[model samples]
Target: MTEQHDEPRSGTSSPAAASPALARLVGMPAPDFAEHVWSRAPLLTRGSDLPRDFADLFGPDAVDELVARRALRTPFARMAKDGTTLADRTFTLGGGVGAGIGDQLSEDRVLRELAGGATLVLQALHRSWAPVQDFAAALADDLGHPVQVNAYVTPPQNQGFSDHYDVHDVFVLQVAGEKRWRIRPPVLEAPLRDQPWERHRAAVEQAAQSEPFLEETLRPGDCLYLPRGWLHSATALGGTSIHLTIGVHAWTRRHLVDAVLGRIGARLSADVEARRSLPVDPGRSSGSEVAFGEDAEVVRSLVAKALHDLSVGEVVEALRPQVRAAQRAEPLGVLDQVERATHDEQGGTTWRVRRHLAAHWEDAGDSPVLVSRVGRLEVSADDRDAVAEVLDGIRDAGDLDPRLRRRLALAGLLVPADVSGE
Candidate 1:
């Protein structure tokens, strides 16, 4: 399964006396866990309070299968001189699998060349994987964006990657063993360069010109958050090291403008003036076709206005739920059959609801009432009576009320328990 790192420490200053160690790291203002701060700076913590028994999340057979498939790379992931590694790992049947498999690790090539059958482990964070999914959901809610997990295993002396940076911000968790990380200062601050592979190759060839701002060895339970565009490299120290990189998606004003422009383009073809033939110039002796100017300025202006409207908070808010819904929708379809079964007198009912664990929503003051078996609920003071009525049924039936239950079932909120007949 794709490994997940622990959540990074909140860099915010506590009113209470701070630890000397924490004081040193909290030099810059701690970034708010909003959409923007991800992958932008350094936030490190040692002996974190976050759950550390990462291996327990995966089954022994599954772990063995991943290893046997040669999915885990060792002794430094090999990269082409150009700093790009070709990825050939097939993704499992989930959204998380697709995101994790998209990237290449150096060891993948060596294993394939050696004719190994080990498959790369993919961890799914649906409601079924409750603990991990809970953490994921919290992070998504905190960050107001979708999050996915990807893990790489590097053996001692093996460098999983050459000196490079990611397009998105990453939270790295050291699950087991040790890894030495060297992070250079944010150079190309929030760079918009599209060709990261080429940039990585160039940076590697010119390593002598750059220096790392922070260099440290991360042991188990350590967490590091690195912002986008910061150059860094990691190598396993002396034993097998497993690390999780929680990547956050980046959105920009340019992306919003692009979307608006696309909408405008679709409407332009309907303009009769734009489609009309240019007026022919008969007076000229030359037989070349005359070109007339189409008034595209109006369309451009409209697109710019639309983009301006979208540049503020509304666009992100509008897009957030849609994005969350899409991620939440995936496991929902798969869990449908599981939610349909009725419980017999002898068997306990199992109900499963799929929730995207990423911190995708902004908590607007009031905490939304989220019940595992009932699906996501937005309760208001006015609806307290209704909510209590539903809760009454939940307490009695060990499920939601019938109408609400059917709705939740249809929404993939509650699935039938997979129970053996008594």
Candidate 2:
């Protein structure tokens, strides 16, 4: 059985200094929690680190700002009452005042829905909220996987959704008020993205009938980690409830197999024997010959050869490009970079690696290339050490090769370190 520890008794709230990446946010050593609880069991971390507070992401005022001022559209924001989703028209209207506006959130309609105990869901907060975007990017970088953020706001004594299981693991942060969570063991273990709770309603109901494995009221400053497929339901208690759910969509063995098979498919397409058409009619075949018999053997041999040709390294390398492509760079300050380029004499500027930009080194032909969110950039072997040094920590602009610094800065991989302080 996985060992469980109560609230961390003697740990510092320094995430970067902690062993695991997000440990500071959860109040535990990251490495220990990763090995003992991550994707293995549930954990409840209680703390009130003021600096790590999630007020910047969402709150009652933030909700009003998003719904009334952000000009959000359907799917981006949704309202649910008693577990059923309300229609878009229930809380949306044609953009009236703004030019080229599509759909705007109607505050009056949304308030009416909320008054009736409807839970407001702000989907994809990672895209809409800067704080959530940064939070997700940090966790994704640390975990080497993608992360999505969402917020749930439910009125007092009302439940948003019924007991259900998510296909992706989630880190639940109770941002405000309190929520009573009832959690039970998963009916299915580590279910795939396609495997939803609705398909096994009967089994879930049966499991919910049993004593919950965990039942607690999560107050502000509390956090919970629930692995994929863990059955759970929660209701706002006494006052309005607000929480942030960081969903981690972990990469699985199936993804690797698919990557390998995709390469195999390309190889099979080049084989003439595998491509040859089968007999049109088996009835016209000779005595012992059956329809598709000869072709089946040929296809089987081709598959065997393809499987033999597949290698772990090849599959991993093949998937790397896709991973790199998925990461997108944020809007760059082109004018600032241009101005900095002209003022090469200015040497006091300290440059740092851009935040949330996924970067890694890979072997290419005779040298290594730095693959970042922007694209794969080939650098000379002699400059690799310099690249490594810069990525390790903030560096003075004059300390770097002027050309290299300019290139990195223009590419959005490097930013002025002082920008954050500003």
- Highest-scoring model, lDDT: 2
Q: Which stretches of candidate 2 lie over 4 Å from their true place?
A: 1-21, 48-53, 100-102, 279-290, 330-335, 342-348, 360-371, 376-397
lDDT tens digits by residue: candidate 1, 249-324? 5566666665555544554456555465545556334643332233345445655655555444654444444464
TM-score for all models, in order of appearance: 0.59, 0.84
How well does model 1 score by local distance difference test? 0.49
Q: How many clashing pairs per prediction, in order? A: 28, 1
lDDT of 2 at 222: 74
Q: Pairing residues by index, what is the TM-score of model 2?
A: 0.84
RMSD of each: 10.1, 4.2
Q: Per-model C-alpha lDDT, please?
A: 0.49, 0.77
For model 1 the local lDDT of residue 2 reads: 14
Residues 40-110, model 2: lDDT tens digits:
87877765642365675567787888888888887889888877888888888877755445556888988
By summed lDDT, which 10 consecutive residues of candidate 2 come out lowest? 1-10
